[model samples]
Target: MFRAREYKICIIGDSGVGKSCLITYFLTQKFDSNNKVTVGGAYHEKQLFINNEPLHLQIWDTAGQERFRSMTPMYYRNADLIILAYSINSQKSFSNLPGWLLDVQKYHDGDPILSVVGNKSDLEKYRKVETKEGKEYAQSIDATFFEVSAKSGTGISEMFGKIAYQVAETRDRAKQNKTGYINPESQTETNKKGCC
Candidate 1:
């Protein structure tokens, strides 16, 4: 039995960290050597099958500049998953992730699943954010971390897979809650009342 699920995800990080490049690479599989800095944000959609079930994902790639920060909360509110991207070559980008996470926590209702991506792995020579530090910070915030190179298409598929898995899990939990099996007391109360 194959069911289709829809997921909404957002990519947020500091400016010039290749957030747009990552999206372009994942969806189009083509990298722009002269990719322009995203002004506000960009959107992309991709579909995949998980356990033979079709899953459609809508991804929002947000700008990382301070001027654009105020508009981020609106997008974060509706996201099922959030990806905080940073460049391995830029320490400032990595350092700014905590503030971004804080924004998500403050504006979003529930605790959303997050993934931290240290992009530009192809430029290992200029790497600034240590893998151990990145992973540790991700762990501190309960986020999954991966080092990826949008240029080489490294780890993009796995990143999306993680997002899909989280979405599937969330959907399954929601389904259980809707069926009332997850909350027996609520189910009992509802069943006691007349059909309405």
Candidate 2:
């Protein structure tokens, strides 16, 4: 009788920052060299297991172009997590992070889990944005940060694993709060009876 939960995750960043590529690689485990840009937004899902409980991740890959900025909010509504991606090789992409963060805050209802991802980690040789700078910026905003290479499939599993665990914890807490269950002993029993 295990209950399944679904979490919505959104990715936002400047164009050519590899937002689409990251999602594509995560979903299919194959990188597209053509670099097809996302138009408005795209939705994808993956069924994951956290602590033996099923969790469905509804991932939204938003367009990074300015023309699609206005519609981005629609895709991020009710998102449990938001990933701010930037190319490590592009300083301009990193510089535009403030505006992107503002946009997410302006539209999302509450404090969703914000993750700062430095994409294109495989291009470290040409990197303009240092790892320290990206980490510091993420720290400044109190967001989780990871340097990942969608092209090389590096750090992808760890990042997604962290997201799944976090979102599951949030859901578990919400469920407990809604039922006013504060006793840890009873809570453990309730969880064992198939709540996740």
Candidate 3:
């Protein structure tokens, strides 16, 4: 028998950074070069194992256009993990990350478990966001960073795997504390009964 754990992840970034493409590649293991801009939001699900435990991940892909920004906070509120996407070829997209981060902070209380993805890595010839710069920015905010090409299936698995591990770890810690508290209380009750 297998028990499946469910997790919710949200993707955010500027338009044209290929946020939808990354989710497609990870879930379907295939990429569409002609993918269109996401209108409001889309969701995809995939089942995988993290440390031998079954995990069902529901990924929410949000529209990166300016018009959709107002509706984004509702999506962020329930996210267990977040992926901040950027395109290396577009300087504007890269520069807009700070604003995106701020939105996440404001809506999500600045959760620490975030992955910073520099997408469209296949176009490295036209890259403007240097690898060091992306890494530095991620470090400053305590996020894991990766350079990925959703079109080429680069770093897609690794990024999701890291997020899964972080989620699992957080869940495990919570479970341990719950168990520890209950066990001690039961033991105290047994000792009191014996004394009476």
Which is the leading candidate under lDDT? Answer: 2
lDDT, each prediction: 0.83, 0.87, 0.83
Q: Which stretches of candidate 1 lie over 4 Å from their true place?
A: 1-3, 177-196
Off by over 4 Å in 3: 109-112, 178-196
**C-alpha RMSD of candidate 3:** 8.7
lDDT tens digits by residue: candidate 1, 1-196: 6456788899999989999888888888888878887777777888887654578888898888899889888777888889999999999999988889889989988667888999999999999989999999999988888999999999887887766776666666787878866745324544333221
Scored by lDDT, model 1 comes in at: 0.83
Q: What's each prediction's TM-score?
A: 0.87, 0.89, 0.87
lDDT of 3 by residue, 12-112 (tens): 99999999999999888899888888878888888877655578888899999999889888887778888889999998998999999889888886454
Best model number under TM-score: 2
Angstrom error at residue 69, model 3 = 1.0
* Tens digits of lDDT, candidate 2, 103-163: 9889898778888999999998999999999999999998889999989989887788787
In candidate 3, list every pair of residues with a backbone clash: none
| Poorest lDDT segment (10 consecutive residues) of candidate 2 | 187-196
